[model samples]
Target: MKEFEEPTLSADAVLAGLSLAGRVRYAAVGLAGLTVALLVGALWATEPSLPLRTHVAFGGIVAAGLGWAGFAGWTLTRRVPLFARDRVIAGVLALTFSGATAVGLVLVAATRGGTTAVLTASATGLVLVTAALALLVTGRRRRAELLRRKAALTGR
Candidate 1:
Protein backbone atom coordinates (compact mmCIF):
# COMPACT_ATOMS: atom_id res chain seq x y z
CA MET A 1 0.00 0.00 0.00
CA LYS A 2 1.24 3.48 -0.89
CA GLU A 3 1.24 6.19 1.73
CA PHE A 4 -0.35 9.53 0.90
CA GLU A 5 1.92 12.52 1.22
CA GLU A 6 1.02 16.12 1.88
CA PRO A 7 1.78 18.46 -1.00
CA THR A 8 4.67 20.87 -0.44
CA LEU A 9 3.97 24.51 -1.16
CA SER A 10 6.50 27.00 -2.52
CA ALA A 11 6.78 30.55 -1.21
CA ASP A 12 5.20 31.83 -4.41
CA ALA A 13 2.31 29.44 -4.00
CA VAL A 14 1.83 30.61 -0.40
CA LEU A 15 1.78 34.24 -1.51
CA ALA A 16 -0.54 33.43 -4.38
CA GLY A 17 -2.96 31.82 -1.95
CA LEU A 18 -3.63 35.09 -0.18
CA SER A 19 -6.62 36.85 -1.70
CA LEU A 20 -7.33 40.60 -1.77
CA ALA A 21 -11.01 39.90 -1.34
CA GLY A 22 -10.34 37.90 1.80
CA ARG A 23 -8.31 40.75 3.23
CA VAL A 24 -11.09 43.18 2.48
CA ARG A 25 -13.57 40.92 4.23
CA TYR A 26 -11.33 40.72 7.29
CA ALA A 27 -11.05 44.54 7.33
CA ALA A 28 -14.80 44.93 7.14
CA VAL A 29 -15.38 42.45 9.96
CA GLY A 30 -12.73 44.13 12.10
CA LEU A 31 -14.25 47.56 11.55
CA ALA A 32 -17.72 46.29 12.35
CA GLY A 33 -16.55 44.57 15.56
CA LEU A 34 -14.65 47.67 16.69
CA THR A 35 -17.66 49.83 16.05
CA VAL A 36 -19.95 47.51 17.99
CA ALA A 37 -17.52 47.30 20.89
CA LEU A 38 -17.19 51.07 21.06
CA LEU A 39 -20.94 51.52 20.98
CA VAL A 40 -21.49 48.93 23.71
CA GLY A 41 -18.72 50.41 25.86
CA ALA A 42 -20.22 53.87 25.47
CA LEU A 43 -23.64 52.61 26.43
CA TRP A 44 -22.29 50.73 29.41
CA ALA A 45 -20.38 53.78 30.59
CA THR A 46 -23.36 56.05 30.23
CA GLU A 47 -25.82 53.79 31.99
CA PRO A 48 -25.39 54.61 35.65
CA SER A 49 -28.18 52.37 36.95
CA LEU A 50 -26.97 49.13 35.42
CA PRO A 51 -26.45 46.29 37.88
CA LEU A 52 -23.01 44.84 38.58
CA ARG A 53 -23.84 41.71 36.62
CA THR A 54 -24.90 43.76 33.63
CA HIS A 55 -21.68 45.73 33.82
CA VAL A 56 -19.63 42.58 33.94
CA ALA A 57 -21.49 41.14 30.93
CA PHE A 58 -21.02 44.34 28.95
CA GLY A 59 -17.34 44.44 29.83
CA GLY A 60 -16.83 40.88 28.68
CA ILE A 61 -18.57 41.57 25.38
CA VAL A 62 -16.50 44.66 24.77
CA ALA A 63 -13.28 42.84 25.58
CA ALA A 64 -14.10 39.92 23.28
CA GLY A 65 -15.13 42.22 20.45
CA LEU A 66 -11.97 44.24 20.81
CA GLY A 67 -9.93 41.05 20.73
CA TRP A 68 -11.62 40.01 17.50
CA ALA A 69 -10.95 43.41 16.00
CA GLY A 70 -7.34 43.33 17.06
CA PHE A 71 -6.83 39.93 15.43
CA ALA A 72 -8.50 41.09 12.25
CA GLY A 73 -6.44 44.26 12.16
CA TRP A 74 -3.29 42.24 12.63
CA THR A 75 -4.29 39.94 9.78
CA LEU A 76 -5.03 42.84 7.46
CA THR A 77 -1.77 44.62 8.20
CA ARG A 78 0.62 41.65 8.14
CA ARG A 79 0.06 40.75 4.47
CA VAL A 80 1.52 37.65 2.81
CA PRO A 81 5.02 37.72 4.26
CA LEU A 82 3.97 36.68 7.73
CA PHE A 83 1.10 34.33 7.04
CA ALA A 84 2.33 31.67 9.46
CA ARG A 85 3.15 34.23 12.11
CA ASP A 86 -0.30 35.72 11.61
CA ARG A 87 -1.88 32.33 12.23
CA VAL A 88 0.03 31.98 15.46
CA ILE A 89 -1.06 35.41 16.57
CA ALA A 90 -4.63 34.64 15.65
CA GLY A 91 -4.47 31.42 17.63
CA VAL A 92 -3.16 33.26 20.66
CA LEU A 93 -5.89 35.86 20.40
CA ALA A 94 -8.55 33.23 20.02
CA LEU A 95 -7.28 31.26 22.97
CA THR A 96 -7.20 34.33 25.17
CA PHE A 97 -10.68 35.46 24.21
CA SER A 98 -12.20 32.03 24.47
CA GLY A 99 -10.54 31.20 27.76
CA ALA A 100 -11.72 34.44 29.28
CA THR A 101 -15.20 33.85 27.95
CA ALA A 102 -15.23 30.35 29.38
CA VAL A 103 -14.12 31.53 32.78
CA GLY A 104 -16.67 34.31 32.79
CA LEU A 105 -19.43 31.94 31.81
CA VAL A 106 -18.43 29.51 34.52
CA LEU A 107 -18.50 32.28 37.07
CA VAL A 108 -21.90 33.41 35.91
CA ALA A 109 -23.20 29.87 36.10
CA ALA A 110 -21.85 29.41 39.58
CA THR A 111 -23.41 32.65 40.79
CA ARG A 112 -26.72 31.88 39.16
CA GLY A 113 -27.00 28.44 40.78
CA GLY A 114 -26.14 26.67 37.58
CA THR A 115 -29.21 27.40 35.54
CA THR A 116 -29.62 25.39 32.38
CA ALA A 117 -29.04 28.38 30.10
CA VAL A 118 -25.93 29.46 31.92
CA LEU A 119 -24.59 25.94 32.02
CA THR A 120 -25.16 25.59 28.29
CA ALA A 121 -23.38 28.84 27.64
CA SER A 122 -20.51 27.74 29.83
CA ALA A 123 -20.24 24.50 27.91
CA THR A 124 -20.20 26.38 24.63
CA GLY A 125 -17.50 28.66 25.91
CA LEU A 126 -15.40 25.68 26.96
CA VAL A 127 -15.80 24.18 23.49
CA LEU A 128 -14.60 27.39 21.96
CA VAL A 129 -11.60 27.45 24.25
CA THR A 130 -10.74 23.89 23.28
CA ALA A 131 -10.99 24.75 19.61
CA ALA A 132 -8.80 27.78 20.12
CA LEU A 133 -6.21 25.64 21.88
CA ALA A 134 -6.20 23.26 18.94
CA LEU A 135 -5.68 26.18 16.60
CA LEU A 136 -2.76 27.38 18.69
CA VAL A 137 -1.06 23.99 18.70
CA THR A 138 -1.59 23.52 14.97
CA GLY A 139 -0.25 26.99 14.25
CA ARG A 140 2.89 26.41 16.28
CA ARG A 141 3.56 23.11 14.56
CA ARG A 142 3.00 24.61 11.13
CA ARG A 143 5.30 27.53 11.91
CA ALA A 144 8.01 25.13 13.08
CA GLU A 145 7.64 23.09 9.90
CA LEU A 146 7.87 26.20 7.76
CA LEU A 147 10.98 27.37 9.58
CA ARG A 148 12.60 23.99 9.14
CA ARG A 149 11.81 24.03 5.43
CA LYS A 150 13.22 27.53 5.07
CA ALA A 151 16.41 26.55 6.89
CA ALA A 152 16.88 23.54 4.67
CA LEU A 153 16.23 25.55 1.50
CA THR A 154 18.74 28.21 2.55
CA GLY A 155 21.33 25.62 3.62
CA ARG A 156 21.41 27.18 7.04
Candidate 2:
Protein backbone atom coordinates (compact mmCIF):
# COMPACT_ATOMS: atom_id res chain seq x y z
CA MET A 1 0.00 0.00 0.00
CA LYS A 2 1.13 3.55 -0.64
CA GLU A 3 2.09 5.50 2.45
CA PHE A 4 -0.13 8.48 3.14
CA GLU A 5 1.00 11.49 5.05
CA GLU A 6 -1.36 13.07 7.52
CA PRO A 7 -2.36 16.34 5.90
CA THR A 8 -3.61 17.69 9.19
CA LEU A 9 -0.27 17.10 10.90
CA SER A 10 1.00 20.35 12.33
CA ALA A 11 4.59 21.37 12.85
CA ASP A 12 4.05 20.95 16.57
CA ALA A 13 2.66 17.47 16.05
CA VAL A 14 5.61 16.46 13.95
CA LEU A 15 8.03 17.80 16.50
CA ALA A 16 6.23 16.05 19.31
CA GLY A 17 6.38 12.70 17.57
CA LEU A 18 10.01 13.14 16.68
CA SER A 19 10.82 14.08 20.23
CA LEU A 20 9.13 10.99 21.61
CA ALA A 21 10.48 8.78 18.90
CA GLY A 22 13.96 10.13 19.46
CA ARG A 23 13.82 9.36 23.14
CA VAL A 24 12.75 5.79 22.48
CA ARG A 25 15.31 5.36 19.73
CA TYR A 26 18.09 6.63 21.95
CA ALA A 27 16.95 4.36 24.76
CA ALA A 28 17.01 1.35 22.50
CA VAL A 29 20.44 2.16 21.25
CA GLY A 30 21.68 2.68 24.77
CA LEU A 31 20.23 -0.60 26.00
CA ALA A 32 21.68 -2.62 23.18
CA GLY A 33 25.06 -1.05 23.65
CA LEU A 34 25.00 -1.55 27.38
CA THR A 35 24.06 -5.19 27.00
CA VAL A 36 26.91 -5.77 24.62
CA ALA A 37 29.29 -3.91 26.87
CA LEU A 38 28.29 -5.90 29.91
CA LEU A 39 28.74 -9.16 28.09
CA VAL A 40 32.15 -8.08 26.94
CA GLY A 41 33.05 -6.77 30.36
CA ALA A 42 32.16 -10.07 31.94
CA LEU A 43 34.33 -11.90 29.51
CA TRP A 44 37.23 -9.55 30.05
CA ALA A 45 37.01 -9.91 33.81
CA THR A 46 37.08 -13.65 33.69
CA GLU A 47 40.57 -14.97 34.17
CA PRO A 48 40.58 -18.00 31.91
CA SER A 49 37.00 -18.47 30.82
CA LEU A 50 33.44 -18.10 31.98
CA PRO A 51 31.06 -20.89 32.78
CA LEU A 52 28.06 -21.95 30.73
CA ARG A 53 25.85 -20.83 33.60
CA THR A 54 26.98 -17.25 33.08
CA HIS A 55 26.03 -17.35 29.41
CA VAL A 56 22.41 -17.97 30.35
CA ALA A 57 22.20 -14.61 32.10
CA PHE A 58 24.01 -12.98 29.22
CA GLY A 59 21.48 -14.47 26.84
CA GLY A 60 18.69 -12.88 28.84
CA ILE A 61 20.42 -9.52 28.66
CA VAL A 62 20.83 -9.84 24.92
CA ALA A 63 17.19 -10.78 24.57
CA ALA A 64 16.09 -7.82 26.64
CA GLY A 65 18.22 -5.52 24.52
CA LEU A 66 16.78 -6.87 21.30
CA GLY A 67 13.24 -6.67 22.59
CA TRP A 68 13.65 -3.14 23.84
CA ALA A 69 15.25 -1.98 20.61
CA GLY A 70 12.59 -3.65 18.51
CA PHE A 71 9.72 -2.16 20.44
CA ALA A 72 11.29 1.27 20.58
CA GLY A 73 12.03 1.35 16.88
CA TRP A 74 8.54 0.16 16.16
CA THR A 75 7.19 2.94 18.34
CA LEU A 76 9.33 5.49 16.52
CA THR A 77 8.04 4.70 13.04
CA ARG A 78 4.43 4.52 14.10
CA ARG A 79 1.98 7.44 14.26
CA VAL A 80 2.83 10.02 16.90
CA PRO A 81 -0.05 9.16 19.16
CA LEU A 82 1.38 5.70 19.56
CA PHE A 83 4.36 7.17 21.33
CA ALA A 84 2.77 10.16 22.97
CA ARG A 85 0.60 10.31 26.11
CA ASP A 86 -0.92 6.91 25.32
CA ARG A 87 2.53 5.42 25.28
CA VAL A 88 3.05 6.47 28.87
CA ILE A 89 0.13 4.30 29.82
CA ALA A 90 1.53 1.45 27.80
CA GLY A 91 4.91 1.91 29.42
CA VAL A 92 3.45 1.80 32.87
CA LEU A 93 1.49 -1.32 32.10
CA ALA A 94 4.59 -2.97 30.70
CA LEU A 95 6.67 -2.02 33.70
CA THR A 96 4.09 -3.36 36.09
CA PHE A 97 3.82 -6.70 34.37
CA SER A 98 7.55 -7.09 33.91
CA GLY A 99 8.29 -6.15 37.49
CA ALA A 100 5.68 -8.54 38.78
CA THR A 101 7.00 -11.33 36.63
CA ALA A 102 10.54 -10.80 37.81
CA VAL A 103 9.46 -10.83 41.41
CA GLY A 104 7.42 -13.96 40.90
CA LEU A 105 10.28 -15.68 39.20
CA VAL A 106 12.64 -14.79 42.00
CA LEU A 107 10.19 -15.99 44.62
CA VAL A 108 9.70 -19.23 42.80
CA ALA A 109 13.44 -19.81 42.54
CA ALA A 110 14.01 -18.98 46.17
CA THR A 111 11.22 -21.08 47.55
CA ARG A 112 11.84 -24.08 45.40
CA GLY A 113 15.57 -24.51 45.47
CA GLY A 114 16.43 -27.66 43.57
CA THR A 115 17.57 -29.00 40.23
CA THR A 116 13.97 -28.95 39.09
CA ALA A 117 13.63 -25.29 39.96
CA VAL A 118 16.85 -24.48 38.11
CA LEU A 119 15.62 -26.33 35.10
CA THR A 120 12.30 -24.54 35.28
CA ALA A 121 14.02 -21.17 35.46
CA SER A 122 16.23 -22.03 32.54
CA ALA A 123 13.20 -23.06 30.53
CA THR A 124 11.44 -19.82 31.39
CA GLY A 125 14.45 -17.79 30.40
CA LEU A 126 14.67 -19.58 27.07
CA VAL A 127 11.00 -18.91 26.45
CA LEU A 128 11.48 -15.23 27.15
CA VAL A 129 14.48 -15.13 24.81
CA THR A 130 12.44 -16.74 22.07
CA ALA A 131 9.61 -14.29 22.56
CA ALA A 132 11.99 -11.34 22.43
CA LEU A 133 13.52 -12.62 19.21
CA ALA A 134 10.04 -12.87 17.76
CA LEU A 135 9.35 -9.26 18.64
CA LEU A 136 12.66 -8.16 17.20
CA VAL A 137 12.11 -9.92 13.92
CA THR A 138 8.51 -8.80 13.47
CA GLY A 139 9.23 -5.21 14.45
CA ARG A 140 12.06 -4.99 11.98
CA ARG A 141 9.92 -6.43 9.21
CA ARG A 142 7.02 -4.10 9.94
CA ARG A 143 9.19 -1.02 10.11
CA ALA A 144 10.96 -1.97 6.90
CA GLU A 145 7.66 -2.39 5.13
CA LEU A 146 6.46 0.96 6.42
CA LEU A 147 9.61 2.66 5.22
CA ARG A 148 9.37 0.98 1.82
CA ARG A 149 5.84 2.28 1.40
CA LYS A 150 6.84 5.76 2.51
CA ALA A 151 9.77 5.83 0.17
CA ALA A 152 7.64 4.67 -2.75
CA LEU A 153 5.09 7.40 -2.14
CA THR A 154 7.64 10.15 -1.64
CA GLY A 155 9.75 9.11 -4.60
CA ARG A 156 6.78 9.35 -6.92
Candidate 3:
Protein backbone atom coordinates (compact mmCIF):
# COMPACT_ATOMS: atom_id res chain seq x y z
CA MET A 1 0.00 0.00 0.00
CA LYS A 2 1.26 3.53 -0.79
CA GLU A 3 1.80 5.92 2.10
CA PHE A 4 0.00 9.24 2.18
CA GLU A 5 2.12 12.35 1.56
CA GLU A 6 1.48 16.00 2.28
CA PRO A 7 1.31 18.32 -0.71
CA THR A 8 4.20 20.74 -1.18
CA LEU A 9 3.40 24.45 -0.78
CA SER A 10 5.50 27.19 -2.37
CA ALA A 11 6.56 30.34 -0.49
CA ASP A 12 4.53 32.44 -2.89
CA ALA A 13 1.50 30.29 -2.22
CA VAL A 14 1.98 30.73 1.51
CA LEU A 15 2.30 34.49 1.17
CA ALA A 16 -0.73 34.65 -1.07
CA GLY A 17 -2.87 32.91 1.54
CA LEU A 18 -3.82 36.32 2.90
CA SER A 19 -6.26 37.29 0.17
CA LEU A 20 -7.12 40.84 -0.93
CA ALA A 21 -10.72 40.24 -0.01
CA GLY A 22 -9.66 39.34 3.53
CA ARG A 23 -7.55 42.48 3.76
CA VAL A 24 -10.45 44.60 2.55
CA ARG A 25 -12.74 42.96 5.08
CA TYR A 26 -10.33 43.72 7.87
CA ALA A 27 -10.04 47.33 6.72
CA ALA A 28 -13.80 47.70 6.58
CA VAL A 29 -14.23 46.31 10.09
CA GLY A 30 -11.50 48.55 11.46
CA LEU A 31 -12.94 51.65 9.85
CA ALA A 32 -16.44 50.87 11.02
CA GLY A 33 -15.27 50.32 14.57
CA LEU A 34 -13.22 53.52 14.57
CA THR A 35 -16.17 55.50 13.28
CA VAL A 36 -18.55 54.07 15.87
CA ALA A 37 -16.10 54.64 18.73
CA LEU A 38 -15.49 58.24 17.65
CA LEU A 39 -19.19 58.96 17.41
CA VAL A 40 -19.96 57.41 20.76
CA GLY A 41 -16.99 59.15 22.37
CA ALA A 42 -18.18 62.49 21.07
CA LEU A 43 -21.68 61.93 22.40
CA TRP A 44 -20.34 60.69 25.71
CA ALA A 45 -18.09 63.74 26.06
CA THR A 46 -20.94 66.13 25.40
CA GLU A 47 -23.32 64.56 27.88
CA PRO A 48 -22.92 66.77 30.93
CA SER A 49 -25.25 64.98 33.35
CA LEU A 50 -24.31 61.38 32.61
CA PRO A 51 -23.80 59.06 35.58
CA LEU A 52 -20.31 57.96 36.51
CA ARG A 53 -21.08 54.35 35.62
CA THR A 54 -22.41 55.43 32.24
CA HIS A 55 -19.26 57.38 31.59
CA VAL A 56 -17.16 54.39 32.51
CA ALA A 57 -19.19 52.16 30.22
CA PHE A 58 -18.81 54.54 27.31
CA GLY A 59 -15.10 54.87 27.95
CA GLY A 60 -14.66 51.13 28.03
CA ILE A 61 -16.52 50.74 24.76
CA VAL A 62 -14.45 53.45 23.11
CA ALA A 63 -11.18 52.01 24.38
CA ALA A 64 -11.97 48.46 23.35
CA GLY A 65 -13.25 49.45 19.94
CA LEU A 66 -10.21 51.64 19.30
CA GLY A 67 -7.90 48.89 20.40
CA TRP A 68 -9.52 46.50 17.95
CA ALA A 69 -9.31 49.04 15.13
CA GLY A 70 -5.67 49.74 15.88
CA PHE A 71 -4.83 46.07 15.87
CA ALA A 72 -6.55 45.53 12.56
CA GLY A 73 -4.73 48.48 11.05
CA TRP A 74 -1.38 47.20 12.33
CA THR A 75 -2.06 43.75 10.93
CA LEU A 76 -2.89 45.18 7.53
CA THR A 77 0.18 47.43 7.36
CA ARG A 78 2.97 45.18 8.68
CA ARG A 79 5.56 44.27 6.04
CA VAL A 80 7.48 41.58 7.87
CA PRO A 81 6.45 37.99 7.41
CA LEU A 82 4.48 36.81 10.43
CA PHE A 83 4.44 33.07 9.57
CA ALA A 84 1.07 32.70 11.33
CA ARG A 85 2.11 34.58 14.47
CA ASP A 86 -0.35 37.35 13.66
CA ARG A 87 -3.21 34.91 13.95
CA VAL A 88 -2.07 33.90 17.41
CA ILE A 89 -1.73 37.51 18.51
CA ALA A 90 -5.13 38.40 17.09
CA GLY A 91 -6.68 35.40 18.85
CA VAL A 92 -5.14 36.40 22.16
CA LEU A 93 -6.42 39.97 21.83
CA ALA A 94 -9.88 38.77 20.86
CA LEU A 95 -10.03 36.36 23.78
CA THR A 96 -8.86 38.96 26.28
CA PHE A 97 -11.32 41.58 25.08
CA SER A 98 -14.25 39.19 24.81
CA GLY A 99 -13.55 37.56 28.15
CA ALA A 100 -13.36 40.92 29.91
CA THR A 101 -16.53 42.10 28.24
CA ALA A 102 -18.30 38.90 29.25
CA VAL A 103 -17.28 39.27 32.88
CA GLY A 104 -18.35 42.89 32.92
CA LEU A 105 -21.72 42.04 31.45
CA VAL A 106 -22.23 39.32 34.01
CA LEU A 107 -21.41 41.74 36.79
CA VAL A 108 -23.80 44.31 35.41
CA ALA A 109 -26.51 41.71 35.19
CA ALA A 110 -25.91 40.74 38.79
CA THR A 111 -26.02 44.32 40.01
CA ARG A 112 -29.15 45.06 38.02
CA GLY A 113 -30.93 41.91 39.19
CA GLY A 114 -30.65 40.31 35.78
CA THR A 115 -32.81 42.57 33.65
CA THR A 116 -33.66 41.27 30.17
CA ALA A 117 -31.34 43.68 28.36
CA VAL A 118 -28.44 42.99 30.66
CA LEU A 119 -29.02 39.25 30.46
CA THR A 120 -29.16 39.39 26.66
CA ALA A 121 -25.94 41.36 26.52
CA SER A 122 -24.33 38.92 28.90
CA ALA A 123 -25.33 36.05 26.63
CA THR A 124 -23.85 37.81 23.63
CA GLY A 125 -20.65 38.45 25.53
CA LEU A 126 -20.39 34.80 26.45
CA VAL A 127 -20.86 33.88 22.79
CA LEU A 128 -18.06 36.23 21.77
CA VAL A 129 -15.78 34.72 24.39
CA THR A 130 -16.53 31.27 23.09
CA ALA A 131 -15.77 32.36 19.53
CA ALA A 132 -12.54 33.97 20.65
CA LEU A 133 -11.46 30.80 22.41
CA ALA A 134 -12.07 28.86 19.21
CA LEU A 135 -10.02 31.38 17.29
CA LEU A 136 -7.15 31.05 19.76
CA VAL A 137 -7.09 27.29 19.53
CA THR A 138 -7.31 27.34 15.76
CA GLY A 139 -4.53 29.88 15.48
CA ARG A 140 -2.24 27.87 17.71
CA ARG A 141 -2.87 24.77 15.68
CA ARG A 142 -2.27 26.62 12.40
CA ARG A 143 0.98 28.12 13.66
CA ALA A 144 2.21 24.75 14.79
CA GLU A 145 1.31 23.18 11.49
CA LEU A 146 3.11 25.92 9.55
CA LEU A 147 6.19 25.60 11.71
CA ARG A 148 6.22 21.89 11.16
CA ARG A 149 5.95 22.41 7.41
CA LYS A 150 8.76 24.93 7.51
CA ALA A 151 10.98 22.52 9.38
CA ALA A 152 10.22 19.80 6.88
CA LEU A 153 10.94 22.09 3.94
CA THR A 154 14.25 23.25 5.44
CA GLY A 155 15.26 19.75 6.59
CA ARG A 156 15.69 21.08 10.15
Clashing pairs in 2: none
Query: What's the C-alpha lDDT at position 45 in model 2?
Result: 58
Cα lDDT of candidate 2 equals: 0.54
Tens digits of per-residue lDDT, candidate 3, 23-113, equal: 8877987897798799989999899699887888888889877987987788788765557777898799889878878877877777776
The parts of candidate 2 lying over 4 Å away from their true place are 1-16, 20-52, 83-156
Enumerate clash totals for all models, in the order shown.
Answer: 0, 0, 0
What candidate 3 gets wrong by more than 4 Å, as runs, is: 1-17, 114-124
By lDDT, the best candidate is 3
Q: Model 3 scores what on Cα lDDT? A: 0.81
Cα lDDT for residue 129, model 3? 93
lDDT (Cα atoms) of all candidates against the true structure? 0.80, 0.54, 0.81
Report the Cα lDDT for residue 7, model 1: 100
Q: Estimate each model's TM-score.
A: 0.74, 0.37, 0.79
Tens digits of lDDT, candidate 1, 17-113: 4477878887887997799899999999899799988888899889878977987887776635563676798789889878878887777777776
Q: Is candidate 2 or candidate 3 better by lDDT?
A: 3
lDDT tens readout by residue for model 2, 1-156: 999986885433543455656676657665675677567556645634655545554555555555555565555566653324334433443454355445456556766687777668766755655554555555556555655655564573
Per TM-score, what order, best first? 3, 1, 2
* Cα misplacement distance, residue 73 of candidate 3 (Å): 1.4
